[model samples]
Target: MTTELSVILAGGGTAGHVSPLLAIGDALRAAAPGVEITALGTADGLEARLVPAAGYRLETINKVPFPRRPNAAMFSFPFKFKAAIDQAKAILTEAKADAVVGVGGYVCTPVYLAANKLGIPVFIHEANARAGLANKLGARKAAGIGVAYASSGLAGARVVGMPMRKSIAAMDTAALRPAARAALGLDEHTPVLVVTGGSSGAASINRAVSASLPAIAEAGVQVLHITGAGKGITDASGALLAGAGYRQVEYVDGMQNAYAAADLIVARSGAGTVCELAVAGVPSVLVPLPIGNGEQKLNAADLVGAGGAVLIDDAGFTPEYFATEVLPLLANAPALAAMSAAARAQGRNDAAEAMAAMVLEGTKQQSTGRHPKMGS
Candidate 1:
């Protein structure tokens, strides 16, 4: 009798990690009908909700963050980290996990250590152009390492691309354009620009879009502005701002429709956003968040290099920039088409399946008493 293949997907905290985790889970299930998939995350992380909502069991552990400097937490870090590792080991043992796939988050370190201790194969996927500390440590002994960017800095990592939602990955933009425009109440004949700052929203992008609404309308462009939740643009009296051809919503549950309806996108250069835009063949103006370790800029490199996107720094993505750069680009159909083609060329919709295959293959090798090659 063939025993079922059991796998543990580790990572959480943010949508960036959880999104890819869920995608890999779905792909694994698709590839192996009887595979058992469980997710490891903290109760407070987004995975606590998204993982279960996606129909996979989630195992919770206390978040153990590595302190950057000497502090109280750093002093107690050893005990906390050990406890988390024990919890992970218990979960993995109970699940009989044949392999662990991590997408990179605070939760991954303990899980990686636990899997290593238990002698289970570990597969890692790094979503950022620059490797996160957790992933950098986990990659040391990972049986397979997959990265969304060529410059991820994980030694021996394969560029498998970001594992994205099926809604965006399997989207046929051209076929869905008309219905998507109608659904969003946008005119099919007019150029449509979709603006978003992700779920929590980007204050800078929101401010710039609000300031450029009149210019956007004057350029015969319809705007679908997804202001991050509760971050809607308002006027002096606190009335929500409105323009001739602009539609505002606090959030969009699924982005496929928005991508289909968009002739152009102006948004942050998050790893997920960059990959999704490329997959959907949507041209974009990417404004890297002017903070953090500059990973957002690194994440935008491939798409920008591919000529699918134009990168603008956050400070420069103002109303003046929009008028001089975006409006002119909106009027140029040929440029948009070329950008779309370039974006598509850089897309890898098969990333989830590719990662899934690696996990299963590594698991099979472990079961056969044969070691899988690293980075294979």
Candidate 2:
């Protein structure tokens, strides 16, 4: 008798977490044809909108973050956590999930514990080089683990790379360069530099890039600067520089065009951004966010160490850095070509398929009462 397969993807809050969860969901659906996939998230997270928009059922749970320090919230943490676990267990039962796939977020904590309590296996995917609290806790009981970077420090974590969207995964920069450039109102034969800071813009990057835009334009390269929503031009904090061949926008919905048209990219070193840049084969200067556990630094290490990209500290990412380092790189065709090649070599476009297969394999093993495979 064939056992019907069902899955619960527990991840949310940020796009970094939600995107991978959706990719895995898409992969499982494609691979199994009739697998029932449910997403466990919070109503406030991006997942609430993204998950349902992706055509998957989303079950929301309470947002009970793990406290780090002594506080009243910390004192009440156990009760809140228990409540989340109870809610997760109910969702898991309703979905009749065969496996719980966690992409790393607060929602995963309870889902992981609940799945383990129910004797159902958990699969984890860590998107950062520095593992988060949720993934660290989930890893202990997880049947299998996948990491985006080799140095993620999760025991038995296999480097699966980041699961990128289909548009980015299938993009051919050279073949689509002309059309992409046209779509962005860029000139053919002109090198285009696309600068962005993900969904929420980075102030440091914006200020530095904006200040250096005039000089950058003098270098004969066009700039596509996406300042992000709510961080528009005319802001006192970070103003835009108006110049010929300089295009500024708050956001771009279809980033494939931006990536395709770009000869070089300037952005933060978020795991998703790093992976997307590598897969798109666009050379970049990565500035890791100054906050957090320096995961962005580790996320960009593979490409930077491979000579595909450059790393600059947030403090050092100044207008002078842009003029002195970035402008010259834009002028050097051979160096740019080499960097692009290195980025492509470092990227894995089949990561989604590989991760999907791993989840299914782990599920099958769990059902058969056999030991799941471990290690990279």
Candidate 3:
């Protein structure tokens, strides 16, 4: 009888990490019905909720952040990191993990170390154009490395694309457009622009949209502005400042609906957002977050290069830019259609399955008395 493949999916703290982890877990379960899947995450991270909510058994360890500078935390780092690795070892031993797959997060470093020490195969997937620190460290000894962007600097990493939810991967925007608009209470014929700054909201984006709302409405374009939590534009009466052809919400539960209803998207270009826009074939105006190691800007490159997206610097994405650029783009039907096609051309919905195959392949090799090289 063939032994059941057991795997541990590690990485969390943010949706960027947890989302891919869940997608990989789902793919593994689909590929091998009897596979045992357990998730490793930090107690306080988004994974605490999302992992269980996705119907996987979750194991948590203390978060160990690598200090960038010499400080008190740096002095105590070795001990804390070891403890986290110990916790990972305990979890992996108990689950009898045949292989470990990590997306990228604070939890990944220790999980990689533990899996390595146990002589189990490790698979890594980096979701950004520039790899994160944990993933950078883990990539050195990963049995199979996958990246969502070609520019991701992890050596020997394959460009397998971003693993996303089925709702996004299988979305048929054109077919679902009318029903999606009706569900969102939007008119079927009006050009719809969806603006978001992600879950925490973007103050500059909100400000620019608020200032440009009048012009947008005048152009027969309707707006669904997803202001990040607590960032809603309001009048003195404390009510949201929404008028005809404008809607403001702090969040949207299902992004697929927004993608389906949108003629165009105006948003920050996180890796997930950029990939989703491509997969959904939505034309976009991307204003990358002005912080970090320029990963957001790098994330937008391929889509922009393909002519599916327009890239605007954060400082230049003001009300004037919105009126001069976005308004005219929304009015150009042929251009929007071409942009949609270009974006679709870059979509890869098979990433989850591809990553899952790597895990299964590693397990098969292990079972057959052949082992993947420790640093291959």
Each candidate structure's TM-score, on Cα atoms with residue i matched to residue i, is 0.92, 0.92, 0.92
Clashing residue pairs found in predicted model 3? 201-228
Q: Lowest summed-lDDT stretch of 10 residues in model 2? A: 367-376
Q: Which stretches of candidate 2 lie over 4 Å from their true place?
A: 235-242, 368-376
Reference-based lDDT, each prediction:
0.90, 0.87, 0.90
Query: For residue 132, what is the lDDT in candidate 1?
Result: 92
RMSD of each: 3.9, 4.4, 3.8
Which residue runs of candidate 3 sit more than 4 Å off their true CA positions? 367-376
Residue 329 of model 2 has an lDDT of 85
Please provide, for model 1 over 203-281, each residue's C-alpha lDDT reduced to its tens digit, 9 standing for 90 to 100: 9989888998778778877889999877988988898998887889888766889999999999888898899999999
List model 2 lDDT by residue over 6-41, tens digit each: 889999987788888888888888899867789999
Model 1, runs deviating above 4 Å: 368-376
* Deviation (Å) of 45 in candidate 2: 1.9
Candidate 2: clashing residue pairs, number: 0
